[model samples]
Target: MADPILVFDLDDTLYLERNFALSGYQVVGAWMQARYGVTDFAQRCTKRFETGAYTGIFNHVLRDLGLMDSPDLITRLVELYRNHPPNITLEPDALRFLSLPRYKGKRGLITDGPPRTQANKIAALGIKDQLDFVVRTGEWGAGFSKPHPRAFGYLEQAFQAHPEQMVYVADNAAKDFVTPNARGWGTVQIVRPLGIYKTPPADRAHAPAATITSLDDLTRCLTQF
Candidate 1:
């Protein structure tokens, strides 16, 4: 039988977002403000996304911020997001983790975001060839939300494995770990120390299957599995 598959979250899990020039929401907000003269539009743009209606969440942000008064502006903002310089950095130990011999498993990336921007980051990092699957939200006809079953389904099908035959490592405890744990996939929390915004004290209580402080520590953490 083939070894179990390994599913990973793209941003912050595989390649750390050391310092993003602009977060997804920030990018949308900046476009709204600069293109439409609306101030404080970032908050509104983020609010719509948080509410689970992401069908052109950017387009809506533009309309609410007054940039959509012209259709051409909408097209330009879309183009900008696609071509924006990636601000994410590869975690120092990413190559080591990828090189581990014991991890003889099909590898896949399961991330949620605007398809174009996320694809750019994946391509720029040059790891797409290593990935057996690339599951994106808008591009795959799936719901644009994390912790959604559909997202998991796309991954399982791509990797050709059952839920129990995969281990998913991600950074966020709430969005990344908890639901997958509930879904019966092995879950590891990447415990890279975040400067002021540390992992919530609550995640310590909940406890992931393994806690890895760095990408290099991943092999050690998975020894028992």
Candidate 2:
């Protein structure tokens, strides 16, 4: 088979999503401290997140600090978290994998997040020059996120390749593989040691064709299909 057009997911697949969350927490915390004199907001927020509080973390943190979790306040904090310049880096294996000679000019990225946030991450990772193209689902609209197939379709048109000639490497099995699998695209899940989604797919429909612990093993995984 021809060398497949390699597309990747941005968050946990290329870098630990935890790092982004931590970085954003720091940003939000710093803002809170400066504005409301809450010096421990960042630490408190981080603690809540580490304890698996994935939703309404800000609300919990505010309640802890005896502050009202008002809609305006939550919105402001969220905007601050998503718009800040994130301090993050690519995973070591991903860094090495992207630099490999065989994949040059064959790489692309499809990521979902607030457009500003995703752009900030892509810039911080310094991967813009390394990829042939990047598709940020936010640019299209919230409804176009993974499992929606809009971003994947964009890649197909951009590469002018058959679905079978493309592969999507991502972390979240819950929503990452369904559309790609149905479209005949090869899908591989990269289960990073610190990745957020670790549970087995509920059914085969959501499962990746192959699973690897790191991008370092991506080449070998691709050979199977």
- The runs of at least 3 residues in candidate 2 whose Cα sits more than 4 Å from the true structure, single-residue gaps closed, are none
Clashing pairs in 1: none
Residue 132 of model 2 has an lDDT of 89
Per-residue alpha-carbon lDDT of candidate 1 for residues 1-225, written as tens digits (9 for 90 to 100): 555677888777777553332354567567767855767766775567556564576677666655544577657766775567665666778777776777777888878777877888887777888788878776765565677767787777776677888788887766676666767788787866531124552554234678787878766665556
Runs of candidate 1 exceeding 4 Å displacement: 1-3, 22-82, 194-207
108, model 2: CA deviation in Å?
Answer: 1.1
The weakest ten consecutive residues by lDDT in model 2 span 98-107
lDDT of 1: 0.68
The prediction achieving the highest TM-score against the true structure is 2
Model 2 lDDT per residue over 1-225, tens place: 577889999999999999999999999999999999999998998888888877899999999889999999999999999999999999999999988987643889999989999999999999999988999999997699888988888889999988998999999988999999999999999988788878787788899999899889999888876
Model 1, residue 96: what's the lDDT?
A: 75
What is candidate 1's CA lDDT for residue 211? 72
TM-score on alpha carbons, each prediction: 0.67, 0.97
